[model samples]
Target chain A: MSQTVELKVDLGERSYPIYIGENLIGDTGAYLNKHGFKTGSPILIVTDETIAPYYLDTVVNSLRSAGYTVVTHIVPAGEQTKSLSMLEAIVTTALTGNLDRNSAVIALGGGVIGDLAGFVAATYMRGIRFIQIPTTILAHDSSVGGKVAVNHKLAKNIIGAFHQPDYVLYDVTTLRTLSPREVRSGLAEMVKHGLIWDEAFVDWLEESASKLLNLDLDALKYGIHQGCRIKSVVVAEDERENDLRAILNLGHTIGHALEAVAGYGELLHGEAIAIGMVGASLLAQKLGYSSDIYTRTKALLQKFELPVSLPKHYDVDAIMEAMSHDKKFKEGKMVFVIPTAIGKVEINRNVPAEWVRETVEQLKGEA
Target chain B: MSQTVELKVDLGERSYPIYIGENLIGDTGAYLNKHGFKTGSPILIVTDETIAPYYLDTVVNSLRSAGYTVVTHIVPAGEQTKSLSMLEAIVTTALTGNLDRNSAVIALGGGVIGDLAGFVAATYMRGIRFIQIPTTILAHDSSVGGKVAVNHKLAKNIIGAFHQPDYVLYDVTTLRTLSPREVRSGLAEMVKHGLIWDEAFVDWLEESASKLLNLDLDALKYGIHQGCRIKSVVVAEDERENDLRAILNLGHTIGHALEAVAGYGELLHGEAIAIGMVGASLLAQKLGYSSDIYTRTKALLQKFELPVSLPKHYDVDAIMEAMSHDKKFKEGKMVFVIPTAIGKVEINRNVPAEWVRETVEQLKGEA
Candidate 1:
């Protein structure tokens, strides 16, 4: 048995644990028991086509061995699949499968599947219990915080709810199957965790970059463990993004706009966010909130081979239009989570649109 | 100004006040301020075409006078509009209106709008604040409990969440515009509240049956007040329907089946529930859980001119199939909220299909 680290997201009645370890999926029964999931309850395992072939059977077999009835729902893999149609299909499958409120939905893939399945569980029969079984490194961030949604043509994650999961069962062994780009994309968020909340962790990640990129078991475990710990604390303090939780969107304001401009799936979520982090830092430095941090963040992102500037094809006008539609905008003003220092950020809703345009222009020139 | 009754549905932080009175819609600004809704926040008012012509401007003007940016989204009226497509349209409208996380969605119509708009609010930007503005007597019941959803071809309310609203602003004056059939439909749920929770309230309802059906303001106010009080207590004690809340569904098991068979608009929701109450009472009588209460219940329903028998067109096999698909089923056994007395009920999950079939056959004979 590989070492396990258990962290509880303290949400009072909705609080649940995040269990991170290597090869935890092999001992699924033990984790289910430890978390007090009743054996033999019907389970719906929701995954994407890309993820099902590798680990679906392993999970189904374990649950079946424990006398639980398991049903598998396979959605086509990709960001484009996250829509209202997919949500309806999943709900239809759950109803057709005769799954009831007592039955649990297991999100057994990456962020897309976790989001789709989590929303299904959140609304099926006015909400049912669901557990997250993350399969990719990117999921280390998405799997926690209970913010699940599908994208709209106008906005990503515009239609969703804040539904916490029963527990998150993350097995780092699954990260072995990730492609190199996937590995790098996942690291962006882990680095974000460091930049927004922990300077020491950022330095540690800088030193351990190669091990993390190479998927060393201990390095991967530690990265995900620290990322989830930071996220759990933030979510516990502000489950709804009413205050402290908004800081978690450090790179997201610009990142989400870039993704929308790139037409989703063209740019991986973490890749867009990586550029977003750089844009936010540049704006922060220009605003005199910080000096040198923008260069420092750019260097860190470069070390991980993540994009440190906006893509040349994305014009400032298009990016600004997309950002204007972001849900974070308040009272007709765009809200940007700006990094003021290493491990410190501020939600500045008063950022002038011209400043953002100018920063994007400069970033484009550098690119 | 008509007499007002203020009741609170307490779910800790999720608790909200239900303001019941006549002409309350005219004082919309006062209510919004009382609820701490900041002026100048964007508001999306979701109403149906039928309601928009009647009261939309009044509400929009009130908020606009207070410097709030109000956007009105008018859906077509009726049961057929309660669909995933309609939900998609509403969400799209909210997105197009540039409504953000700080925005509020006001459900400004009857039960269908409440469920649809509430689901939109419940999921829009991962749940935003929403207030229920119920315009029909039937909405008095649907608006309070925060059970919001749209219909699927396979099931009604199959896709939804238990998202409590910030407040329920029910102006009984709106009920004055309802047709007699609409009045009858709304009364069914109120009668169910009396049948399942309070025997004295049932007696009072029976005495005031004519007044309620004729839309007497005081009778309508008292009936809705008592119904909400009962529902509030039940929801407070069991918000998720783990046990006690199931009793609130006394007539809904077979009632939902009848509505499904009747094809949504063929029979109004309350008419179906009225028939469902009779079906359940007959089943209760067959199971020896009650004596003449079934007869007493049928007489009371008839007094309000509510349907007391399943449609003659419905067959036992078809209704059974529909009930089997209900979300209430657990482990292949059907759950029924069977009334054992005028003001008492039990969640009987072990009811034999044979007993239900016989009762439906008898109900058809009576029809």
Candidate 2:
């Protein structure tokens, strides 16, 4: 039996736990039962085509062995799958499968599957219980926050709700099969977790960058655990980004803009955020925060092979227009999560457009 | 100023108030501001084309005069608009208009607009604030409960969530413009509220049936006020329809099936529910609850000119098939809100399919 690290997210009645371990998907029945998922109730496992063949059977068989009826919905892989058309299809599938309020939806892949399935659960039959079985490292950040949505043509995640899952089953074993780019994409958010909230976590992540990249079991477990822990605390305090929770958007403002301008799926979410974080840091420095902190952050990102500058030939105007479409924009003003120092950030809603343009131009030159 | 009756639906953090009156739409600035809506925040007013021509400007101007920036999204009139495609369009419009987390969505039409717009608010940016400005009498029932949804091809309102509004602004003045069939349709739910909760209210409604149909201001105000008050109490006790709230579905089990079988819009929601309520009473009597209750309930429905029997040409098998798609079906068992007596009902999860079939056959003869 592999060692499992369990942590609880305190969200009053909506609270659930996160279990991080190797090969946990093979025996998820115990965790399912502990979370009040009763035997005989139908469970719909929502996974992508890419992930379905890998671990879907293990989860289905485990639940079936426990006397629960399980159904599977295989969505196409990629960001395009997170659209209203896909949402309608998933809802139709759930309804056709006869899932009721007692029935549960299991999101069994990475952030895209978790988000698409989670939104289905949030609105199907006006809400039902759902569990998250995240397969990628980036999901460690997304699965915990309970912010599930489908993307719109105008903006990404523009249509969604805050529906917390019953529990998150994180099997670190799945990370071993990821491509290097996928691993790097996931590491950007893990790096972000340390950059925004904990100085010690940042120092530890920097020290273990090599081992972490190599998929060291201990390093993998600690990275996901710490990322989820920070997210859980922030979500607990501010379930709906009313105040402090916006800190979690440390790099997402410009990150989402980059994804939109470059066309979604052209850049993996974390890759875009990796560049956005560097832009934000530079913006912070330009705003008279700290140049020293920006240099340190840039160095760490480089060590992990994450992008720290905008892509060459990308239009700054298009990115700025995309940022204006972000939900964070209030009454025509752009809001950015700027770091003043390592392990600390501020939501600067009054950042001028000229400063963003300058940073994008400078970052383009650097790239 | 016309008299206004204010009632609160208590669900702790999700609690909101319902204001019933005439001409409230003309001066909604005070209500919007009172409900925590700040000046200068963008507001999306979602209304159907039918209602938009009548009441959209009143609302848009009212909010604008109060220092708020308002945008409008007009959906086509009818039940078909309660769909995922329409939800996507409205969300795209909100995004295009740059509505944010702090911005609010105001549903300014009847039940369809309220449900569609409410679901949009429920999921937009993971839940933003929305106000309900119900323009139809049918909305008196749909608005008070936090049940918002879009219809699935498999079933009506199968895709939705329990997203409460900041406040429900019910202007009875809008009801005066409704057609005779629309007035009758709205009255059915009001009558159901009485039948399920208060015997005295039922008697009062029976006495005021003529005035209600004629659109008397006093009767309209009282009917909506009492109906909302009952719904508010039930929702407060069971926000998610776990146990107690299921009782509010009095006639909906078979009612929804009747609508689905007949094809949506071929039968108005209240018309279908009115027939379902009578059928439910008959089922209760057949199960040895009380035959006298069925007779008395039939008299009240007939007095309001509401349908009390299934259509002559409807198929029993098709109705049963539709019932199977209902959300109340639990683990292969169909659940019905059976009336034991006036002002009393029970959520009977064990009702046999044979009883439903037999009642449908019998009701067809009566029709």
Candidate 3:
């Protein structure tokens, strides 16, 4: 028997159901049919060069067996590949392929392909339904969240729209191919869900970190399902991150800065987030929130073999400046997510900026 | 005393309040204060070479006296200025200007500046709050709508986000300097609002077309207020345009095609939309909606001196291809906004592609 995860993204009727399971890839045909996904339509599959040969054939074969006309667009792999040049190249091919509004794009690969293809779906004749078949572990968080965007050289996820996929097929099988680092990066989010919203989930991570590290299938399924659930509910409540959804940034504030300061792809997102979660925890403890929760969060992160501190040589001022540019800061104060309790997170902006500076200095001394 | 027209966009908490009055420009400071727009924060004013030279200092003076720190960025002006290169340049400046996430951008110009600056605010630090202080008739519609995006050569508004302004100040006095052509483009949206969801507003446009053309402040305010109301209602319901908001594309389907096919900036947006609206109305009539509605909509458009048909020289295939690439067509078939009834709309993908071809042929014949 398969289990269904309910994501309550709060876009009213725009809300959708996300089904996670082992053989979702083989069964997507029915989900497609059930959701009014046009049958026998010419479908353009936008994927990365790295992910296509491995998975495109499966999706294409499934789509073909289901009686659909499939046209595949294979883009070069890498985050750098998500550019105007790439978008135009695919759009030109899509245009040449007689692709129109009725044609759907299956974004194969991780976040980049999802965003690039989703943008293509969004602006191509206004919008189209695209299904996300995320292949990377890092995508476990990004793929389901309705925040589809591509990066500019100056910023990440800079140009995008709030485009929800018609459906998301987690296909835990895809994670089997992820590198060890990818698995670790994705684990940060599972831990993030625990620290920010779910206590039991946190304890679950603390116990199952070994199973996840070993790529245990059931553990992977539980982690992904629960992480998606946390995000889905927040998204269901605040699809645009205007309110409670912003809490999902439990570790993303400093996590993104670490990635940016370290130069993107330098620090694994999950690794940075693991460190960020510690920083947020320490900040929470600094502001006198919960010392026990902070210590436990760090201990759990350590158990996963994730780094909970920055490299010794990284510039503190640059990190601080990068954080100042973080999207969470509002009204001239840097907003930090601090745990009020294990299951409760509060968006804290009133905490003195000097304390953040002090933490940076303290961390520098410890380094 | 001046009357204020309110645009109640239903984006839950992220929704902003729009104030349309005779002197919204002067009231910018007071309104921002009243609406919880943080005081003593860094403000970046985005303007263009054209409008900035005229009123930038005045806006700056107002903010400075209100005890706010204001920084100004001036771009060359016009639709051509709304590009990726320009966005990069401004971001560099914003970063150098030491813009933190707490800072706000005040977009102080027409649609181009509003879209460009709004996108900057949307992208900067993953997103930031920016206020809209529009200086053109066209901006009355755009400034009120939360559809902030930038143009890529592949698609107009291809890259963007649905980030609303903290507040919108639509100063009617600013419209006096706009070219007759600019004012005409602004009316396309007012016309779209009536065609999509506002039957009484359609009657109002019919009754007050001359007043709009004559630059009657009362009629213009009425038009903007009603347009904002319709847009706000749709946006509030579907901020990301997953459903009800798609109705806003009544004429834009063909209008965007006309703009792209004719070459952007060749035909003003409103002019293309006017022609597109004519084509859409004609298509709607042919699809068995109502010939009476078509005549009435066309006559009302004609009264505004909006272009009623496309030029004979434009190839139908070119426009069709442009529409194919329209950010509206979802999968493969072109979706049309056929009148379920005047002021009521149902997105009709059931309309054949043949109807689009036939309509274009008829339009060419009329030309």
Candidate 4:
């Protein structure tokens, strides 16, 4: 059974939906077929090794049942594999699959597949329609947004485009396949969303930390819904994160640095995000914006077994050096997403390196 | 005297204008200063080697005057530089330059620079703001649409994202420094817009081809404006190119395959398009679209010294192979954009490999 979640991105005609439920990918072909998708047109299923083994069969079976010509391309999983090589292989796969301009691409798995596959759709034949069937919880953030990209060796999400999926079917039932670590990782963005825009939501998250950690289905649904809602609203107001969107990066400044410092795959994005949130909280304390929330935030994250400190082997100086290259650094000053208070954050474009250094040092000791 | 052209992307609020003028690199300081741009901000000027000698200094000096901390990363000149390696180099340069999120990147050359630089912006730190100061006629097309990306060694424009610039400044005076071949190169897109969307504009170009060749300022302005207007309409209707945007690739299917077949940098982008239009026209005729128009197109391209025939040494099968790897090929079939008539076009996704090969052979042998 599939449940549909309607999201209006507010971009007039560019607006789309998020169809959430179980057995959705199987029905995706039928849905499109009903929507006038031509018969015998090839359906390209793009996935990463990580998720293909788990869901690729189910999805392909669904397509087969729908009377569509289906083909699949599986690439090595991990951020490192998101490259021109993968793109070319997928294009080759898409070509051999006999896809045409009107043929659909189904992106399976999480952000990596969504991005890699979306990019292929954006450029293939100039542009092709793609559907996102995200498997990871973290994809709640990536999937709702049309920002599809691959990581260049030096930068994450470097090679990409804003190619919106014709439809995004987030089968929540897929969450059963995710490890707790993945769930924890997805929480980071949720927490960041709360810190940046919704204090009440942050309070709700803090109050419901245990339920979330337990993967309470209802709480999980609420979490995904709220996360998508917040993201959808921001996207509606600022479809492209040109201005107001910067607010969404409350914990990303330090989060990205921690990811880079620890290496791409070492730290689960949520663990780094946990540290980033802590770092953000410390920045808030330093700037006198309610240091108390830092403790509460860390406590809740710690409850979830997410990292509350820097990775022990990571070097602070190296992290700060990585910080310098962050997208948030403005005018050569590392901008901190310091909380003004719970549910309130400001882009602290003025936090000195000394503050980052001191906070990083303390976090290292904590680690 | 930098001339300014407004790129009306139609997103409202997120909407900003692109300034195309003479000495934009010099006048750019005031704009940066007025925008509250601070000092010591890392400024990555993404440029190709060809335009570096003629213009990099001016861009650097202008930003420096605005108190921006600045740096330059140069890629080999020409279309081929829009590659994964180039993307990595830009990221590495930014990492080495210590650019922060607050930093800005100035794309200081033509289409290649704008696309690569914008991709750098989209990915570096997960995105940094970039401004475009396009120096070639080709940029009128590349700069306006939010499409930023690079080509794979095996595919053309295969890896990329839709990263729009904060502003784009097109200095027609920049054309003063461009080679005549470069100027002619941009005419291809202008001609493309005319064929796909603006029939009167195509008629205008047909009559003004001589003046355009002579670099008449009025002719240049009209060409740029007309080309952009068609793009503006299309992008506005489909910012993500989901539907109407495909029309913009009027001759690019064959054009891109040619570029990839001959090697990425072998043919200037516009020159390939000139040939592609000739080839697409023949494809159009074979499908009973327009023989007279195809003949006229071949003659016009011949007059401009653009290659109407396929490259002398490249095999037709090899070209077809390259086309097969084209990102547009889906489900084991090739999709071709052929004109219905001189001023009209239709996309045929059902085209077979045999037809593409036969057409290539026929065109390769044509006078």
Q: Point out the higher-scoring one by DockQ: 2 or 4.
A: 2
Worst 10 residues of 4 chain A by lDDT: A1-10
Full ranking by DockQ: 1, 2, 4, 3
Worst 10 residues of 3 chain B by lDDT: B324-333
Candidate 1, residue A209: the lDDT equals 87
Which candidate has the top score in DockQ?
A: 1
Clashes of each: 0, 2, 24, 35
Among residues 3 or more apart in sequence or in different chains, the pairs in candidate 2 whose N, CA or C atoms overlap within 3 Å are A126-B160, A160-B123
Provide the lDDT at B259 for model 4.
Answer: 75
Stretch of 10 with least lDDT, candidate 2 chain B? B325-334
- In the range B105-158, model 2's lDDT, one tens digit per residue, is 999888888999998998888888889999888888889778899998867788
Residue B326 error, candidate 4, Å: 8.8
Using TM-score as the measure, the top candidate is 2
Model 1, runs deviating above 4 Å: A263-267, A287-292, A310-314, A327-335, A349-355, A364-367, B263-266, B284-292, B310-313, B327-334, B349-352, B364-367
Tens digits of per-residue lDDT for model 3, B1-367: 9778776666777877788889777666677677666665678899999998778887988887777777888999877787767877787677667676678889999888999999888767556888999888777678765767666664566555566898888888888888888888788778888888878889889889888988899988888888878777777777666778778788878887888878646899888887877788788787777787778777888888888877888889988888776544555557887766678777888667778888988877653
**Docking category for candidate 4?**
acceptable
Q: Candidate 4 on B69-106: residue-level lDDT in tens?
A: 88888888766788766777777888788787778888
Which DockQ values do the candidates obtain, in the order shown? 0.79, 0.78, 0.19, 0.25
Question: What lDDT tens digits, residue by residue, belong to model 1 across residues A79-131?
Answer: 77888888888888887777877788999999988898988888888888889
Candidate 3's DockQ: 0.19
Candidate 1, lDDT over the whole model: 0.85
